[model samples]
Target chain A: MGRWQPGARERLEQAALDLFLDQGFTETTVPQITARAGLTTRTFFRHFADKREVLFAGEESVPERVARLMAEAPPSLGPMELIAEGLAPAAAEIFEGRSLDYLLRRRAAIDAEPALRERELRKFSLMSEALEQGFRDRGVDDLTARLAAEIAVTTFRIAVARWLDQHGDPDLPATINQTLAAMRHLTSHGGCSPFLTTHDEDHHRRDTGQLHDG
Target chain B: MGRWQPGARERLEQAALDLFLDQGFTETTVPQITARAGLTTRTFFRHFADKREVLFAGEESVPERVARLMAEAPPSLGPMELIAEGLAPAAAEIFEGRSLDYLLRRRAAIDAEPALRERELRKFSLMSEALEQGFRDRGVDDLTARLAAEIAVTTFRIAVARWLDQHGDPDLPATINQTLAAMRHLTSHGGCSPFLTTHDEDHHRRDTGQLHDG
Candidate 1:
């Protein structure tokens, strides 16, 4: 048997997710997670400070990468575009081809448990702050940077939902681009209706008043 | 002594905020809070399920009002506009004349404490879901409704931050409306540039040239 042994961390996370899904997050305990993973309690502790950390594996790198991208991006880009560019590759790497079932399950678990939900929000808030700092580093004003960071996050979320619904077939980068385009359309044309002048409105009303009234 | 007694819940909240601000949220406990409030443990528990609940007393009514406005709004308004209109009055009613010191302190507490931050995110998620449902109830499709809800939340966050910074002096409704207008402008202009062709060409050159050089 020349194969590399499974790391304690990996084993612990897998066991935790399984237990969390099967027995529910509230019912699952650290000792049970460690035992199922064939690791000692000390090993579990060494890997994760607490049980909740198991559900949040790999999230730490997301903000770092996003910050790096924003720092290295072209200076000429507008605030929103710069933030979007910074997030695109990171989103592509972390989100593309990811298991929707796993994500949906994790979301459900968080929704069902108050503690887990709080942890998830803390992660999001950290991400938002990181993005805002990135924009500020590029000389954007505080309020504008904060607003742009928020819009970027909003686009990321909308893209993720769209991607998840499509069974994660679309590349994350493309999905983000498409969502931005849709946002443009939404904000610009106000959803497929031409701007109506007051004259046109009155004439139309006069022309169709009986039809509408009846 | 014909002095009126302060409400138990309000007393508890004031005491909790003071203690949490002074000693930090983690270091504070129920008994200490109740003692500070000059109330019994039973009186404290009657109002709040836990110490943390005391910090977030008005969160429930904000969402309820937002949802009600969304539900009762006229059907002809665009989804985003409808959400904006729904949130504006609520913001005016709830946020005007609010003390920035308490808000800033509360935000700091939440940021410093992981549990509180997560609870805040859960609240945000609930608001987003409520907004989505509101749009759906008005006959909007699922995807569009979700997108609109996200954008609305983003606008709300920006408006809130701006309001907080202005010493809580700006009319919340006007600030919200202005933020929505800014978002619309940013999204509609397609990267916020007048010289689109040149901008795209330069962007393409940078992107492709980077790829080729790498």
Candidate 2:
């Protein structure tokens, strides 16, 4: 209820989120959401396909939008740079203007429900494919493009989780930048990284790991 | 059943897979699976929680095993090296000795079922956390550990996807190594990466991306 002034769709989203968190996603119905919103069930149906869809509104299209952004990125940028640069705006669009209280509750709602979590993960998989397509369409090599898409999505997801964990202070785009920096820091180091370059070394370390655990 | 020489667990697995593929996951029953395997419901229950659980045997403990391996990795290895070295053994233990046909069919069954796919995704989430713990235990910083863990899981998942897509020919560990290499390649690059280092640039690129799409 904190400064959430909006249109019918936003109102419906808020109402559905409230019902979802209060009574649990499984127990809450469209009728309940509509009643809570002081709108008609027709309004609920107009906004979302079903009760579950209320939580994942716009998720299906998010990947497509992000993919298009990736396609439009300057070829001069590295993949990590492209992803950090491309995904930041979409992250801001979805998360920046929203109330922190509104988002935490929504995240809680999705986390509490298995079905919603599943839907979110499915969307992530779809996002990865769409991101890969974005890179492919821009003439990046297959392996490089695929790796970048997956890594970008992973970085974005981690940044969002961190933003929430930190109570949403530094803005989503900044958090993404922070995560992008850390990700680069982790991968850019190359001291002992011909790891598992041979099967014998792989076996030796694996057996040693097991022996220590045992 | 080709070259699947094993114990009760494997027989139940094969029988359950056969039924799941022959019929949809939702349509299959534990009793039917047991009947197909010529085992009793007692044995079936002894091995699985439900019909759905048959598709994800040993998945719950995989993260723990992986985490232990990470903890046991040489402290001198870089986090990237540690993850590659740690994850390969478990990957081998799960996928190496198994028949390619059996593995492919198993993947197909899980992919065809939403619930199974959900369960699998949940396992990956858990693996990310376990991997994070593995890194944390070894004194990696919070951001680097989290980024590395999430990135490692993503790399493993993509590698597995590639292995399956390539008809499971190369050993799973080989696929994982290749994927790890590609992931490193994606993140290691520093050029143009000061990605979204500034907010004004982020907004500019975002508006441009939108304009092009529009």
Candidate 3:
């Protein structure tokens, strides 16, 4: 029972997700999880530090690998492109193989639970920090590095949302590229300055109306 | 006791900060805060919904003001500039009059506590959402608007950090302007593509190294 079997972790994760969905995260306990998995509490403890850890099991390694990839990227590549490339491999490894059902269920559960939502936000913050550090290591200034990191993360999120909607096509890289292209078009086409133009138009309209009245 | 007096809220905030600093946030209680402020526990509850709310008293109004400003901004301004203009008034109103000591102490306390840190992240996320909404209302696409909002938030954060270090000399608006200028320069200089170039260079190096060894 204590042996490190290949399917042991997956079995535990499946059991935990089943329990969490049937009974809310608050109502589920470690003993219940292990009982459902046909494993002892000690085995569960060995696999996960706590119940919360189960949800975040591979988070540590995923970010670490992405960061390493960014750091090892060629110095000549632009910041956004470097991040995009680095994230592609990890997306392929972690997200491409996964079933959409699990992700949808997990996302729904997190959205419903405040504690889980906070944890999820914290995870995104951690990822941003890692990306920022990667940029700084590559000689980007503080503000640019941080901004680039934010943009990269934002693009990744947009891509993931689109991918999820597509019923798990596993083309996260393509989705991210599409998002980046959209941003470029928006910025280049003067999308950012629309507010200024709108204000001017409003003022002109007011003046025209007054002239007509006169 | 339940009346909303003008200065009552400020007095309570001062007292709560003092108690939080003297004894850690976790160790301090509502009774202690009220006792220091020469008020009853009932008064504290009336002024602030909870102890955590004391730290975040006026923050709820910030996002609304920012959104309004963004919506009313001149349409001719670019997305980045539009966001900068929208943020300036709100930043001035919320952060301009605050003492450096108050800001530093509040930041330190929030950084030292995990719960407070999570709360801070959540607040930032909420603000980002509002900014995104403002952009969308102005005819920007969903993904572009979200990324612009995130970049704006990142710039605001960097500016605020720099402002906090100046010990009360520079105003929030000026600092924010400087940060925005830096971001514009960086973006225009092709900084975003560095990550991509770097990744490609690394790939090339790896391929060359393997070929040389072979």
Provide the overall lDDT of each model, using Cα atoms, as 2-decimal numbers.
0.72, 0.75, 0.73
Give per-residue CA lDDT, model 3, range A84-201, as digits (tens).
5666675676664457787877777777777888888888778888888888888887777877777677667667777777766756678777776555434323344323255544
Tell me the tens digit of each residue's lDDT in model 2 across A91-186. 876564578888788899999998888888888878888888887787777777778877877888888888999997787889988887667656
lDDT of 1 by residue, B23-122 (tens): 9898999999989988888777767789888877777776677778887787788876576567777666665544668777667677787668667777
- Clashing residue pairs for model 1: A118-B118
Candidates, ranked, lDDT: 2, 3, 1
> Which one wins on DockQ?
1
Runs in model 1 deviating more than 4 A are A1-8, A83-86, A95-112, A192-214, B1-6, B96-105, B190-214
- The CAPRI class of candidate 1 is acceptable
lDDT of 1 by residue, A1-214 (tens): 1234457666787788888878888899999998898777877776677999887877877788778888888887887566556667767666554467777666666667777867776777778888889988987767667767777877777787677667667866788887876665556444423344565446334432312543
In angstroms, how far off is A68's CA in candidate 3?
A: 2.1
- Worst 10-residue stretch by lDDT in candidate 1 chain B? B187-196
- Tell me what TM-score chain A of model 3 achieves: 0.81
Q: State fnat for each of the candidate structures.
A: 0.45, 0.64, 0.52
Report the Cα lDDT for candidate 2.
0.75
The weakest ten consecutive residues by lDDT in model 1 chain A span: A203-212
| Candidate 3: stretches off by over 4 Å | A93-97, A187-189, A192-214, B1-5, B74-78, B192-214
